[model samples]
Target: MASFSGFIRKSPDARLAVFLNAKGVHAPDDFNWQSEGRGTKLVNDINGLIAELPEGTQDRVKAELDHLASLATPQTMTAAEQVCTAQRIDLEGLQGIQDVLLMLAIDHPKTLERVAAQASLMQRTGGKNWSAFQFEDDGEPWALGDDIARAGFVTDAIALLNLPEHRKREADWYTSIRVHPITGEETEVLQATIYVEARAESELTFGPSEGLERQVFQRVLEVGIACNAKERIVEICANGGKKIRDQYASSFAKHFAPQSAPPVEAPRRDVLLNALLSNPSFPTEPADGIAKVQVSSLEFYSVGGGFARFEHLGDDETIYQFLERQFGAQSPIHSTGWTITGATLRIMQTPEDGTGLSVSDDNQCRFLTISGDRFNAAQHGRCC
Candidate 1:
C-alpha cells in the first residue's frame, strides 16, 4: 500500500503514478505521462478508486490528489482534469460540471471550482427556488435564475439568458417571473433585453414584441389566486396592471400606421386590464382614467457633431416614435446618418412603488451635451 507520507515524498508525477498503481491500475510499459487521453484516463481511474474506498480514506486520498493536481502545468493537465481531481465533485455522483463550464465559458480550474462551490451551496439552500438546470436532464447544472440568485453568483443578465439552448428562438427583450412554491412571493427570474437592428425594426412597426411579459404577469396572478389574495390582485390590476397595459396599447396605436404596416400575428393582451375589470369586487362603472404623462426626457447625439434633447409630454409615445419624430424627414438629423452607438433609458420612480426598476451600474445613462462624430467613416473608406 502507498502510505500518505510515502506518496508525499515522491515527485508530483511519480506520486500520481504510484497512487494509481497502488490502487491496482497498473501502468503499461509504454505508459507516457504525455500521451493523449492519459489525463482523462487518470481522472476516471482515480474517481473509480475513490468510489471503492471508505469515506475517511477517500477524503485523505482526495487531499493528496488535489496537492498533486495543483502542481500540474498547462502542458501536463487539462483544466477539466484538474478540476475533477482537485474538487472531487465526482464523489457526489453529480454530472454536468463540464456543461456548466462550457455554458459559462470558464477555462480555468480555480474559477470552475469556485463557481461549482457556489452552485452546490445554492442547491443545498435554495429549495424549490432552484430552476431546472437545462443542460442535462438528470443532473442539472446550477445556472439559471433562483440558483444563481441564491448562490450570490455575480453574473450579468445576458450571460444568464445565453445559458439555455433555446435562446435564439425567444424574443430579445422580456421578463421571467418565478413564484416561490411555499412563500407564494414573486421574483423576477430575469429581465433582459438585447437591442439588435432587426428587433428595433420589428418594434418600430409592431409595439414591443410580445414576449414573456404577459406570461409572467399571468404567473403572478395565478400565485395570487392560489394564496387567496384576490383583492391584492385586483388592486394590482387597477394600479400597476392597467397602467402598464394602457401605456403599451397607447404606444402601439400611436406608432402603428394601418395603411403601410404588416399584419401582426396577434395583438397584445390586456392581461392586467382584464384582471382588473373581471374581478367581482371591481366597480361596475369604468375606473378613473390613468394620468396622461409622467414627465420623461430623451437626449440624443447625432453621428456628426450635433446634439439634441426632447421632452415627452404625452404618455402614448414610444421612445422609438419620439426618436423618429425628432429625426424625421425634414429634420437636420435625418440627413446626417445618425447611427445609435449607445443608448440608455433611465426610469425614476419613488421607493414606495416597490417596482424595483433601476438602471444597471454599467449601463447608466450619461448626458453628453457636447459631442463629436462617433466614428470617422472616411478613414474606413466610407462617406459620412
Candidate 2:
C-alpha cells in the first residue's frame, strides 16, 4: 500500500506505514524516517496520512520532524527551559529532552514526536519543575496517549536509580533520588552519597569518596561505635569529591544509632587497625603525609577484606617511641623515620623478613625508647 519510510517522515502518526508494514508491505522495524530519499511517491502517501490527523497534530509533527532534521548538522545546545507560558512552549529543558528525543526519533519518529509534543504540553502546564519526559498528564497517555513513553519513564526511572549498579557493589548504604519532572532536579540534593549493603551483588560506588572511603574503612571500628550501626557497613565513592557522608548521614547514623554512641576511648589497637598495621606500609611513614597516602582503587574495590588492608595510617606513640628509640642511631640497617601524630604514627621501614624480633597483639609491652636521626644496625644488636 504505502512505503514505511514515507509514512514515518510525514505522518503525524506513522500508522499508515505501520499499517502497511503490519500487513507485510514492509518490515515493521526497518523504517527509519531520518534517512533521505525513501521514495518520491512516499510524499504523496504522507500527505494522504496527514489529512487523517486531528488537525493541529500536524504542526507538532512538523516541528518535531524539522528539529530532528536539524540534528544532521551541529546544533548548539542551550541548557535551559523555555518558560514563556501557554503563549509558547518552554524550551528550557529542550537540551535534555532533545537528547532522548533525538535518539528515539531515529526510527520511531511519529511515536516519539507525539510523546515529545505531549511532554512539551505537560511541561507547559504541569509545574515550573515538570520535565519533558515525566509529564503530569491528563491520564490520556496512560489510556492510549503514549504507552511507549509511559514505559520509557519506568525504564528510565530504574536506570536513574542505578538499582542494578547498586546491587553489584555490595553497598552497606543507600539513598534515594526522586527527579522533579519539569526542572529535572534529582532528589538527594546532597552532592554525593556512599551506600554499603551488607549482602548485595552490587554497590553504589563513586570516586569522590575514595579518601573518605579509606578513612571509613580504616576507622570503621570507631565509626561503627560512633554511629552505632550494626550492619556490615561499607563505603562507596560515586566520583571525585561526592560527599557521601552528609548525603546519607542521618540514615547512616540511624543505620548505626539514632543518637551517637558516646565517644569511647579508642582501644589499644582497634581490630581494623591491628589488621592493617600488620601490613608493611602502616607503621613506617611520616604521620603528616600518611593521611594522604595513595592506595590503588583495587584496594578500595576489595574493601574490608584482608588483602586490601593499607598500613599507611594512624599513630601509635608506643610503637613510634619504640622504633625511634630502639633503632635510634643504631636502628635497622635501613632506618625508617616516623612522625608521631596524636594516636597515629607514620614510619618508613624496610620490609622485614621475620628476622630480628616478632611483634604481635599480645606482646605490645611498654619500655624505654631511644631517639636519633640515624642508626647503625650492625654495631648495636638491640631489637628495633
Candidate 3:
C-alpha cells in the first residue's frame, strides 16, 4: 500500500485514480476527471476509504479530499460541474465535504472566475429536489434555499426545485379576519395554507372571483412555498393579490369579473362622526344637564395643538358645558373663566406630570401639553 503521506503529496488526479483503483474500480488509460459519472465514483471511493481508516486518520483524509474537490483551475466550469454532480449524488452522506464543495463553488474568488459556470452550477445543484436537503437549524429545508436566494442568487432554481412537490400536496383552508384600517371592522378572509411535507405551513388568502381566486391563490401559494416568502405572501393577501393576478392574466382572463370597490375611507373626523350620528340610538341632542358624553375621535398634532370631535351635540351647547360633560364635573375645566376662548386649563402639572389643556380660537380643537399620567390615561381610555 502507498503510504498515506505519499497519497497526500500526489496530484489531485493521481490521488483520485489511486483512490478509485483501491476500491476495485479501474481508471482508463486516458481517465478524464470531468467525464460523466467519474466524480460521483471518485467521491464514493473516497468515502469508502475514509470509513476503513482509523478514526484519527479520517479528518486528514477528508481535508485532502476537500482540497481535491475544490481545487481551482482554468477549467473552472468543468470543476464546478463535477462538484455539483458529486454533491447531488451524495449530499447527506459525504461528511460535510459536499457542503464545503458547494461553498467553495459559490464563495471562492478563484472559482467565481467564470460567472456563467457559477450560475449554471447554482441552478443545477440548487435545483435538486428541495426535500432531499436537510437544514441544520430547524430542519425546514426550504429555508436553506431562501437564505441562498436572499444572498442575491437566482430564485428560479429554488422555485423549480419546490414546484413538483407543491403540486402533489394538498392545502388546508381556513378563515382569517382582515380589519378595516379606519373603521376597525373585521371581514372574514379565506386562506389556503400549504406546506412542505413535515415542515411549517405558509398561508395565502384568496382573491376576488371564485375562479380567479383559485388561480391567484394557487400562483401565490406556489411562489411563496418555493421561496419561503411568508411575509410577501401575507402582503399579497392583504392587497388582494392584484399584481399576481395580472401576472397570469391569460389563464385568468376567462374567469375575470368586476371586483367590488374597497370601502371608501372616511378621511376626516367630522365625516366619521357624521356616520356615528346617523344611528337612531346615538345621542344627537345635548344632555339637558351635565352628563357623560362619548368622544368620537381625538387627533394630536406635533405643533402643540390637536382636536377631539364628539359624535354629536345640540347646536346650542357651549364649550364649558361640553367640557364638563366630557371630562366630568370636578375636572379643572370647571374653574371660573376656564370655558372662555384662549383660556388655559392647567391640570396635573408637576415635575413629572406636565399635562395641561387650552381652548383653541374655534373651541373645537384643543392645544394639549403632551406628557404625564393624565394624557396617557385619557389615550388609553379611548383606545380601550
> Across residues 1-384, which tens digit of lDDT does each residue of candidate 2 receive?
222333244433343344333323442264444344545655555445555655566555555445554432221121112111211333344334334344345544444433333333222322332211111222221111234432332333233334453432211111222233223444331111122232323334444745423222211110110111121222222221223223322233232223343222211210122222222253335533322221111111111222211122223434334444555653221223322111222222222343332233113222211222111222112223
Q: Could you tell me every candidate's TM-score relative to the true structure?
A: 0.18, 0.17, 0.18
lDDT of 3 at 266: 16
Q: Tell me the alpha-carbon RMSD of every candidate.
A: 26.5, 24.9, 26.2
Q: Least accurate stretch of 10 residues (summed lDDT) in model 2?
A: 219-228
Q: What pairs collide in candidate 3? A: none
- Cα deviation of 80 in candidate 1 (Å)? 16
| lDDT score for candidate 2 against the true structure | 0.29
lDDT of each: 0.31, 0.29, 0.32
Please report the TM-score between candidate 2 and the true structure. Answer: 0.17
Q: Output the worst ten-in-a-row residue range by lDDT, candidate 1.
A: 219-228
- Give the poorly placed runs of model 1, Cα more than 4 Å off: 1-100, 103-107, 115-295, 299-309, 315-319, 328-384
Greater lDDT among 1 and 2 belongs to 1
